[model samples]
Target: MRFATYELDGSVHAGVVSDDGLHTLPSGTTVLDLVRAGLPAALTAGSAALTGPPTPLDLARLLPPLTPPTIRDFVAFEEHVEGVVASVSGGSGVPAEWYEAPTFYFTNPYALIGAHDDVPVPPGSRLLDFELEVAAVVGRDGSSLTPAQASDAIFGYTVFNDWSARDLQRREMKVGLGPAKGKDSATTLGPWLVTADELAPFHDEDGFLALDMRVSVNGVEVGHDLLSNMGWPFAELVSYASRGTWVRAGDVLGSGTCGNGGCLAELWGRRGEQDPPALRPGDVVEMTVEGIGTIRNRVVPGIELPPVRAARSRTRAR
Candidate 1:
């Protein structure tokens, strides 16, 4: 079943997408509510009220499914890791620790945007880019789970675009910490959420979903890859993420960027340092995963916020 958080009659409602149209649940209940309540059964119970005629998708203004309770993005694709390291670190191979477990970072959850929303290019970032990815929403609170058990916690899947400020990110990484101001701008996560049960038909021998992912910028295809190629499966990433901390319902775990030229950094590395194109105002980014649908966003220029560096410098002196 596909669940969505959409706007109708100026109110946001959660519901399942049926052949006829949008079947809405109670007012104020959200997509996150259904996932927290559990899918399939919650949806099959016929409790949520079906809104008027099937609301045409185009007419329904979408949100980010629901503003996640928390967001963790992992680098589960080896090709992507290798390309990123090569581009930034010059010649280092994949980090040894990455092979031991899934490595990830928590991002600002408040910066989320929905399908067809406008993404403002961060101030001071000339090299803005998008990371094409897939994300899983957690259904229940859990901790210290084995990979197999963690798989059950996944509520569903959706397309994710982790918007990036390459120039800002590169500058921060030089300080030996990580992407902070560089990445805290905006992340997109919608179109619709597809329940995990809907993807049983696409599981591979290893039980990993074999969905295809593609990305286009301004109608030009830039990347394509099969999700089955991920070096670390979603279960392992979730298991790793839940270690020592609670993975609550509505938590989002992104698949990071896919391989096969998922981001411009990888493209630039492979192309011998040729300047890769940066997203400019009015550029449309459309990312699609086979099981989930597409999330299309337009880039808009945003004004600069005050310099964080100057503020930190003053604190350091005191």
Candidate 2:
């Protein structure tokens, strides 16, 4: 089963996605309710709602999956790190400790654009790039757990674009602060939250659910990778992430960028001022990660800018 937070009549509500249609769940609700009630009860309630000629919302709608919660994204892929490091002036590595456990950064809750929304060209972000990742939607609450246990706490998966403003991020992350403007300003996630069961096939290499991923700009294929290329598995990440922090239902955890040309920084190799693949007005970027459908976004320049001081201050803290 897939769950979605969506807008209808100016309000946000949760719903279960069914082939019949989207069945509304309670506002500020969770899949836990359904899971606890057992799949039968959850499906019954969701199925019953489809009878009244429910409002037909675009499946690719956006509503805060969690009205507002702390979002933690993990840098679990080594290939991405190597790619990023090799592309930068000096390359992107630190002490080996950087890889000791799952590493994550906090993102502004409001920067989230649903699966279908347009990603505004961020201010002063000439090097805007997209990352292809799969994020976990926490279903069970736990402060810490072992890797095997962590696997059971998840509710589902969704595709994520950890959009980046390279130039600004580079300047800030170098100072040892968790990602700031480079990542904070905009991170697009969600077409729908797919339940853990639906995502299970991807877990077993024996079954090896073929999750092919691809990113395209102006209809040109620039990046592609298989989900099987992930370095660390999801269960380990959740276990590591939960060990030192409270992760509750609805909280989001990202599987950092995947390998094989996952981002522009890697696809094009090192970039100089002379050649940057910065997104501009009218340029469209679309991505699809095998089982997880596709998210297409168009880039348009921002007409108005926020106060320079505040923007500068926020970027500094990030």
Candidate 3:
């Protein structure tokens, strides 16, 4: 079932999407509640237990599926890594360490926005970009999990747009530490969450989901690729994420950007161009994955802040 959280009459509600409308779940039940309970149980309980009338899907304003407790985004697609590396560093190949395991970095959970929300250009950024990806939401808490266990722990999937500020990211990484402020501006997740069972038919024997992924800018198609092309699967991403640490319910694991023009950086990288058009105010970005649905967001001007100054070194020759 496709589960959603939406605002109606100035109040937020969580429900199951259906042909007729969105069937409201029990009062006070958030998507996180259902994730914690497990989708199978929620399905078994069914909408028959709902206390109110269904709300028309179009009438409600959608919100992020849930506020993730933690957001770990991984670069599981080698093609994307190859292209981005070439664009950023003039490198033509991925690092060997990338092949040894699925690597991820934590993004700010507080920076999330809804499917159709306006994405403000991050302050001091000129090269704004959007990344086309999918994210898996954890259903239960687990640490040191195997791949199979990680698969079982996934409750659902959602369309994820990892908005980026390329120019800022470039400067910060020179310090060898971050994509921090560059990436912390905003992230988009929604339309709704598709339970894992609903996507089972798309899974291959090797565990990769053969879903079609696409992205568009201002109604013009920009990129397309298959989710199955990833070097590592979502289960492996989650499993690696769980090594020596807990992945709790509501923690989101991203599939990273797909190849073949998944983002503007990749496009620039492939063309060996340093300056291509980047996302600007009023540009709309829409990302879609078969079975999981779509998320569309519009870019807007950001509030500029005073520039940060370098800190004085205190431990020189002491």
Give the best candidate by TM-score. Answer: 3
- The numbered model that scores best in lDDT is 3
Those runs of model 3 whose alpha carbons end farther than 4 Å from true positions after fitting are: 49-52, 274-276, 313-318
Order of the predicted models by lDDT, top scorer first: 3, 1, 2
Q: What's the ranking of the predictions by TM-score, best on top?
A: 3, 1, 2
Q: List lDDT for all candidates, in order.
A: 0.83, 0.70, 0.89
In order of appearance, the predictions have TM-scores of 0.93, 0.83, 0.96
lDDT per residue as tens, model 2, 73-104? 87766777766765543555533865676677
What's the CA error at residue 133 for candidate 3, in Å?
0.4
Candidate 3 per-residue C-alpha lDDT over 1-318 given as tens digits, one digit per residue, 9 for 90 to 100: 888888989999888887677887778988888888887886764456444577877788899988788999998999899998887656788999989888889999999899899999998998999999999999999999999999999999999999999888888878888779878999999989989999999999999999999999989898999999999888888899999989999899999999988999998998877444899999999998999888999999999899888888786775
**Which residue pairs show backbone clashes in model 1?**
21-54
- Clash pairs, candidate 3, are none
Indicate the TM-score of model 1: 0.93
